[model samples]
Target chain A: MSDIKARVSFLGKSANILIWLLLIGACAFVVTPLLFMFSASFMPAIDIMKLPYPWVSDHIHRQNYWNGLRGPDGSFVFLRNTLNSLIVALAVTITTVLLSSLSGYGLAKFRFKGRNAVFMLIMATMMIPFETIMIPLYMVSMKMGLQDSYAGLIVPFLTNAFGVFLMRQFLLTFPDEVLDAARIDGASEPRIFTHIVLPNSGPAIATLAILTFRSQWDNLLWPLLVVQSDEMKTIPLYITKFMAETHSDEGIMMAVAAMASLPMFILFFTMSKYFISTEGLHSTIKG
Target chain B: MQYNKRFSMEQKKAVWGWIFVAPSLLFFLVFSFYPIFNAIYMSFFKKNLLSLKPPEFVGWGNYVYLFHSKTFWQSVSNTAVFTIGTFIPLVVFSLMLAVFIVSRPRFQKFFQMALYSPAALSSVVAALIWLLIFDPRGLANQTLNTLMRTSGVNYHWLSSSSMLRLSTIIVYFWKYVGYFTVVFVAGIGGIPDYLHEAALIDGADSWKDFWHITFPLLKPTTLLVSVMVMIQCLKTFSTQYLFSTSGAPTRPIDVITLSIYNTAIKDHNIGRASAMSVLLFLVMLILTWLQLRIAKTEDVTYN
Candidate 1:
């Protein structure tokens, strides 16, 4: 019996080590593409097919960044596109957070006619994929002359169903007693929301903001239709058009891809706690 | 008089509620609800995307045409193939990774961040990066060659039909597996620790514990992730779009969204595109409903 127990323990120990090795291997597989992208971005050009795989460039060539930013024709066109992406992403994030929080607060705290109906209406739309509505949305934008403008890019997606759902989920857990205390102190509804509720909603707002900003930053198809001019193009659109139109060097293309990803990487690294926390998962998962 | 004052105050709060919800409701009406209705309406009409003339009423013409169209059916099959191919591995691998990460003795965050790094990047960037790897002389073939001790063998990753499909699946898997894993980790975290403890006290082994407890409790999360993955895979556009436009054959990778884009913008046939959108929407709706129904039946059996 002791001999059998000893063998079982030994087997479990080996299994645990194997599992850890597998975990490390999976991480390596995940990081390899991005690592390759980063390494290739710094090279003038790489013989990517070289034996043993040139996982790192021989020398860090920084000019790829300059070349990438300058566009294929040396016109510095990508700067404008990057700025457009920043503007749209920032605008969408700010608006989505504000609108979602307010609406979420109302539904969570108040009992009103049509409150549940309104919440359900918004949530039901979550099932409708953006692709389903893309054609008619494009037509509506065209009819409204929203195409090829900042408004066209920003207006339709100012708020999202997920944001509302997330905010509501968070707010439902907020203490009603605090709101009642504020009300008893003669604080108005708007004042209470601005001072009391908003102050307490940091985690939810952060999760929602990061999610909204990331999505808008990476938005592609709608912008593909809405923006006709290169000047108005977002980063994803610019990258696609650049790749298609320029046939630029691989190094420069990787540099552009790296630049596009840098913000999200920074965002993830700096605020990663929010990302992996239950709050972040809460944003995506149903309650 | 006192009751009347209290009643007015309750009414006032309700008014504030409406005031707060009005903006979002109005935005949804214009951007979401109206567009859905419009897409359905437009599916029955023949219209040129660029033409100023009024649309011609075609009734069921667009739907019938799509039913008979080779390209439409091809897009549907491509979408089905991609969705099934991607979501199964996605659901399984992510769940496995989540279990691995959660069970680990250390560095859980490091594993998660490493896995989720790709999720942060745009699909365009993901596709572009993979395109480089899929290049004939790129890391993909080089890695394969070295691993197999073969010389100068090209996998034809982006050229061969089967290989091309596999390549897209690999990119998507890399991008989203970490994301779904993180979600699953969260789901596992939500399982009460005392249940695990009780199982241990009752002499349940780890594998049995997971099967009898964690897996059953994780059903909702698994359902959620599967549904999300299915919808996302069905709606996959950017990777396939970038890949095809970058010189890979369009026939193999021409997903529904890409087809919709081409039909509307390239072919200038908005009516046909709208009809396709409607069909895709129905497919998504029915699949979700079916999944939910299956889960419900299984729940009954479990009890």
Candidate 2:
């Protein structure tokens, strides 16, 4: 009886170990490309396409990193583009969060005719893919003389349905008593939002900010459509153009990718816990 | 008299709401709704870049052309296959991972963080990383070759057309699994522990308990996840463009969105592309509405 119990225990332990191994193996599979990308950024152009094996040189070509930093003509185009992307992303985040919060507060706190209709309209917009309207939107931008400008890139995406939806969801949970107290104190509607509501909704605001920033930073197609000049190129477009121009220079391409991804990686690493928790917050608002 | 008081309050509220939501509504109309209507209108025209003539109203010409085009049908089939291929495996793996991680509460946090990290990375970045791996001499093939040396059988994972599609689907699953897993974990966590406790006391096995207790409770979450996944699959373009070769056996892997992009931007056939986009939109809208209806039914049953 003791032997049988021991056997069962051993089998369970083995099964658990197998499960761990399988999980780890799957993770390794997913991580392989990212790992290779980092390593290949250090390899020479000729070596990049070569089969990575035991024969593959372990030597790191440091020049690839240097060449990546210094452009073909020794210009700071890549760095400038990186900075451009950062500024645009930050601007997008700030505008989106502030506007969405204000709008969300208005929708949530105010009782008015067609309030539900307005909210429904915003929600409906969320389903419309940008691809469906790319041409006319581009034409409109050109007609407004906003072509090749940051204003053009920023304006269309400034007020997102998703951000408004998220903020509305958060604001719904705001207690009516808090607003009543503020009203009783003779605070104006805008003042109540600024002093009372905004101060209290830090987590939701942060989550919206992160999501907005990430979306803008990684936005490719729209930015590609709008930004024409090299000066206006965001990081993704910069990297894509760089890849096309320097097709043979894998090292440089990888280096640029690393640089492009670094800021977002830092932001994500720092705020991942908050981001994960916000999923629960979404459920609460959704519920 | 009571109705008058309520009406006044509602009026005040409505004014505030409209004032606050005005900017969003304006942008939504200009950038979203107007564009959609414009695209629908454009779909009926025969417009070209060189010919600045008034768009010749050709009702259903673009749509008819789209239906007749082999590439369009091919794109539809590819999208369906890609959607189904990625969706099923992704949902299953994510649920399993969530369940496993949640089963052991001690290491749950670590597992959750590890799994969720990939989701934080953008789809573009994720695609780039996978492209590197699935390149001919890249890590995936290298590792496979090393493993196969003992048996003397080598395999090309990405070079072959079918394998390329399969590989792309796998990458899609890998990138999105964490996102759905996080959703599932949140959903599972929301399930009250009392139900599970009662089931345990009733002598239910783990699987039986999950079937009876956990599954029913997760209906809303499953609905939400399914809707999001379906929409996501519909919008998939960048990864396919990045990974697949431009022409030939691999060329057929181009999905509907990519085809629309090719037609509009590359081929400069904006009218036809707009037609395809309108069709795609309608299909997605119908699918979403159906899912919501089903979810409503499930909500009623479960509650």
Candidate 3:
């Protein structure tokens, strides 16, 4: 019996090691594309395709990075576009978080007529694919003279259903008595919302802001349809334009792509803890 | 008198609740709900952008044409393959990864961080990076060639039509497995440890415990993950656009979302595209409803 037990333990250890190896292998496979992209960005134009390994070259073509940052005429077009995306993302995040929190607070804390109906309506909107409405939205944007403008890009996404849903859910965790106490202290509803509620709901707001910012930054299709000029292009649109115009220049294209991803990569690596913890908290809060 | 006053207060509370939620409701109606209805309306009309003529009512003509079109049918099959191909592996891999991570708390944070990193990369960026890696002389092909040299195994991983579909599925899995793993981790973490402890005391092995306890408990999460995956697959476009070569191949990789993009943006056939959108929406709705039903039945059985 002891011999058999020992064999079983040995088998389990080997199996666990194998599983760990497989897991690490999968993680490496996932990161390989990103690594290759980074490597390719530093390769010379002539060496882009000459490869068993793209990064096996003797010298790194650092000029590709400079050219990527500068435009065809040596202007800082890429930096300008990145700035535009950041601005739009930041503006959208702020607007969305504020609106969502206010609305979420109302829904969670207040008892009102037609409240369930309104909430259900907002929930149903989540099912409607944005693609189905793109054309009409385009026409509307044109009619409203908002095309080619940041306001057009930011305004439409400001009142996000996901944000409202997330906020409402978070607000549920707040004690009702606390709000009642504030009310009895003659704290006005708006004041309670601005001071007590907003101050306490930092984590939810942070999650919403991060999600909204990332999405808007990466938004491709809508921006493609709306932004006509190269000046108005966001980073995704900028990379796409670079691809279309310079299909032959793999080094430059890869360089631009790397630049587009750098900010998001930094943000994600630094703020990953929030990403893991926020989802469950939001779900339970929403429930 | 006090009871009557409290009832009035309750009514007042209900009124204020609606007032707070009104802006969101209005925004949804005008922007979301209205556009969907508008798409349905647009589907019934025949109007070309260049002609600028008022829409001529076409009734079910658009739908009938869509059903009859060869490309539409091909796209439908492609969508099915894509959906099934990506979802099965994604679900299995995520669950396994979650279980592995959950078992080892020491490396849990690191694994979770690494897995969720891909999601932070924009889809466009991900597509661009994968495009480079999947190129003929790219890392994937180069690695395969090296293996072929050593092992005498030669295969076209992305050149053939079916192989291309498989490649796309692999890319999809790599991108999404982390997101779903996180979700599953949340679900698995929520399962009480006492249950696992009890099973251990009863002489149940790890595999047996997982089958008898963990898998059954993760049903709701499975349902949620499946639904999200299906919707995501339906919306998939940028990766396909960036990866596939232009023009038809022996095995087509055209999915429904790509078809809509082609018709609307490339072909400039807006009416037909809107019709396609309507059909896609209906299909998604039916599938979602079916999934909900399956989830409900599973819940009943488990209970």
Best by TM-score: 1
Order the candidate numbers by lDDT, best to worst: 1, 3, 2
lDDT of 1 at A68: 94
Candidate 2 wrong stretches, greater than 4 Å:
A1-11, A46-57, A280-287, B1-13, B147-158, B244-250, B290-303
- Candidate 3: the clashing residue pairs are A111-B13, A111-B14, A112-B14, A112-B15, A113-B14, A113-B15, A169-A285, A169-A286
Tens-digit per-residue lDDT, A145-264, candidate 1: 999999999998989888888888789999999999998898989999999999899988998898888889889999999999988999999999989975648888999999999899
- For every candidate, C-alpha RMSD to the true structure in Å: 3.8, 4.7, 4.4
Ranking by DockQ: 1, 3, 2
Runs off by more than 4 Å, candidate 3: A1-11, A54-56, A281-287, B1-15, B148-159, B244-251, B287-303
What lDDT score is found at residue B157 in candidate 1?
99
Best by lDDT: 1
lDDT of 1 at A256: 95
Maximum-DockQ candidate:
1
Model 1 residue B238 CA deviation (Å) reads 0.7
Error of 2 at B34 (Å): 0.4
Per residue, candidate 2 scores C-alpha lDDT tens digits across B1-303 of: 685576775576567677888887888888899988988999999876345677889999999998898889989998888888888888778777776666656666777777776666666667666666666666667777677763323345556777877877877887777767877887777666666766767777566666787787777767667766777787787677655532224464788888877786677776888899898889777765655465445433322
Give the range of the ten consecutive residues with the poorest summed lDDT in model 2 chain A. A1-10
Report the candidate with higher DockQ, 1 versus 3.
Answer: 1
Task: Report the CAPRI category for model 3.
Answer: acceptable
lDDT of 1 by residue, B1-303 (tens): 685577787898898999999999999988889988888899999999999989999999999999999999998899889999999999998998887777762567778888988999999999999998998888888878988999889999999998999999999999998999998887777776667766767877667777887799888778877877887899899999999999999998899999999999999998999999999888877765655454344333222
